[model samples]
Structure formats: C-alpha cells, structure tokens
Target: MDAPIRKHNATDEERFWAKVDKSGDCWTWTAAKTNGYGVFRIKPRNMVAHKVSYIWAHGPVPKGYEVDHMCFNRSCVNPAHLRLLTHQENGQNRTGANTNSKSGVRGVYWAQGQWIARACIGPKTILVGRFDDLGEAERAITEWRIEHMPVSLRDRRRRVSGPLADA
Candidate 1:
C-alpha cells in the first residue's frame, strides 16, 4: 500500500503528457475520459490518466488500492491532490449521505421519531448516541468522526445543514 512511485517510461510519459491540460491547480486530461477519468490506450490496455499521473509521480499502484482525488475532481491529474486508499478508507470521503437517511448527514439517521448518531468503521457500527434535536445529532456524529476517522479520509466539504450531497 505504501509502494514508492516513479515514471514508467519516457515514450509513455511523453504520450500521456500530450493529452493533459495543465492550465490550473488541477491538471486536467484533454483526451478520452470514461466517467470523467482520463483513459490512455497502450499496447496491453488502457490506463486511467490519474493513475498514470500517480505512477509518473510515485510508482505502480498496489493491488486493491484506489487512486482517490482529495479535491473531489475526477478529471484532475495533479499527483499532489491524489492519494492511494482502500475502498473503505475512500468511502469516508463520500459527499452524499445514505439515501434512506432523513437527517441528511453521513452518520446521523432518523429512526422512531428520534435522531440517531452512528458511524461504521470497518465492519462494526459505532453508535454515538441518541438525540431529540437534529443539530445535536449532527454534532455528535461530527465529534465521533473527528475523533475516530483518520484525518486524510475526512470529507472537507461535508454537508453541515443541507441535503445529502449530489446523490
């Protein structure tokens, strides 16, 4: 998971760099994109541009580890904004709350007419507490998240008092 990174090859790097538009902070890929991620066709297969960028900056990606964009930008190829994470670790940065959640917060839910604050780390659900007020529930979950979740996995643009993100 902590493997070092280095550019794979010069020819591949040259071809990959040609398609990227480094206009601003988040270097964007100007070529074919599948689901907003850049795709490059090599002899063997296609590689995601951000993954290529990660490889160019770091090294080969470890198995089962995903390249996550901390800035919430799918087209960004900036290596500094990218990180390698497990599926569960990456899930913590999700913008949308659960679809069935009434409180519209990641770990806060409404059940039996009361607000419930809870969070899941790995396979276990940690029940923060129950609250009558929604704000209190949000605060409880926020506190739990701040105390428990790793700092790099936390969502910076989390909904404070609005609908669950762009679900």
Candidate 2:
C-alpha cells in the first residue's frame, strides 16, 4: 500500500519559516505563490506570506497601506525588507521602464531631437518639460518626482549627485 500523507500540526511561526528558503538574500518562500508572491493558508482564508511576515514583525498593516517589497522580490518574506505604502506611493516606486520604451528612463522619451519628460498623477498626464540633453531630462523627472511623490516612494539607493544635487 502507498504511504499516507502525513500532516504535522505546526504553529504559524513554524509553518511560516518552514517554507522559507533561507539560503538567499531574499529568504524566498518555497510554498505556493500567486503572481510571483508567496501565498499561505490561515484556516478560513489565504494570506500573502510577506504580509504575514510584516504582521509577525510589526503589527497589522495600517489602514490604506499595502505591503511593499523593498528588495523588489515578490517571493521575499523578509520583514526587514518590507514596508507599508499607499497604492500611489507603491506605483511611484516601480523600477524600470516599459520594454518597448526607446529611452531607457521612465517617463522621459526622445521626440524631435529633444528629451521630453512627463508624469502621470491619477488619470491626468502632466508634461514636465522638454530638454536638449538626456541628463537634463533625467534631472527634470527626478525633480518632478521629488516635488510630487512622497519621500518614501523615491529610490533609496540613488545618491544625490550631478547638476540637480543641490536642488
């Protein structure tokens, strides 16, 4: 006869850690995932692993704030790399431009020999400005982000340098 599937009565913490692959920087979850993010069952409902980690480390996520992966790894369940952010803030923190984008930078594109910078807030798209140089376009986008987006949404790794460093 085939062996029966054994079910161990593990605690939430134990169950949570048991599925984590601690070998990597991300502490990647080895359990079921949806859209690259880890999913866990908590009796009546399914919960996201990173959210569970956040709740375990801190308290429940604040109202209107969703858990965001600071490392940008969807499968990461490390509490240290998680933060609660508003939807708009989370969108602002997104990395990389669309694959089809000719210009490498997000929100800045080359048109008619000039680099045009633009930004979207909700449904409205605002034209930041047009510049002759790529660096200037980048600076314009950066400045617009600083002025409009929250500080938490800004790229933490980006060091302040170049012409807009003082600004």
Tens digit per residue, CA lDDT, model 1, 140-162: 67767756776434443453333
| Model 2 misplaced regions, further than 4 Å | 1-7, 152-154, 160-167
Off by over 4 Å in 1: 1-10, 151-167
TM-score of each: 0.78, 0.79
| Residue 150, model 2: Cα distance from true site in angstroms | 3.5
Worst 10 residues of 1 by lDDT: 158-167
lDDT of 2 by residue, 1-167 (tens): 99644359868788888889988788899989999999998888999999999999999898899999988899999888899888877888877567887888788988988999998876789999999988878777877877787643444345354456554
Best by lDDT: 2
Pairs that clash in candidate 1: 5-58, 5-59, 6-58
Candidate 2 clashing pairs, residues 3+ apart or interchain: none
- The per-residue C-alpha lDDT of model 1 at residue 59 equals 94
